[model samples]
Target: MSFLCLHFTRNIHIHAFYLKFSRILSTQNAYLNRFVVSLRPLNN
Candidate 1:
């Protein structure tokens, strides 16, 4: 029973961590897109 609880909690932790990591990745992607867009004016 205790083992099951532990496993469940671990799953939740991993899920939260993954969500946070993905959010960071998305924000970084947005920044990179903005940077690329800004550079386009100079490129042409």
Candidate 2:
């Protein structure tokens, strides 16, 4: 029973870590896009 509990807790920890990583990746992508936009002058 204790082994099963440990396995379950480990799974939960991994799931939470992935969720946080995904969120950070999305935010980083947004920042990169903004940085690229700023690099080019939009003078028409």
Candidate 3:
């Protein structure tokens, strides 16, 4: 029973960490997309 509880909590922690990491990645991706779009006109 105790092991099950530990496993559940560990999964939750990992999931939360993954969510945070993904959010940051998506934000950076958006910034990169905007930066690329701004540079496109210059290349033309």
- Going through the candidates in the order shown, the clash numbers are 0, 0, 0
Predictions in order: lDDT: 1.00, 0.94, 1.00
For model 2, residues 10-34, the per-residue Cα lDDT tens digits are: 9999999999999999999999999
Q: Write the per-residue lDDT of candidate 3 for residues 1-44, one digit (tens) a residue.
A: 99999999999999999999999999999999999999999999
Q: Cα miss at 42, model 1 (Å)?
A: 1.8
Task: List the candidates' TM-scores in order.
Answer: 0.94, 0.78, 0.96
Residue pairs with backbone overlap in model 3: none
Model 1 reaches what TM-score against the true structure? Answer: 0.94
Clashes of 2: 0
Residue pairs with clashing backbones, model 1: none
Looking at candidate 3, the ten consecutive residues that score lowest on lDDT are: 33-42
lDDT score of model 1?
1.00
By TM-score, how accurate is candidate 2? 0.78
**Which scores greater on lDDT, model 1 or model 2?**
1
lDDT of 1 at 1: 100
In candidate 3, stretches whose alpha carbon ends up further than 4 angstroms from where it belongs are none
Error of 1 at 38 (Å): 0.3
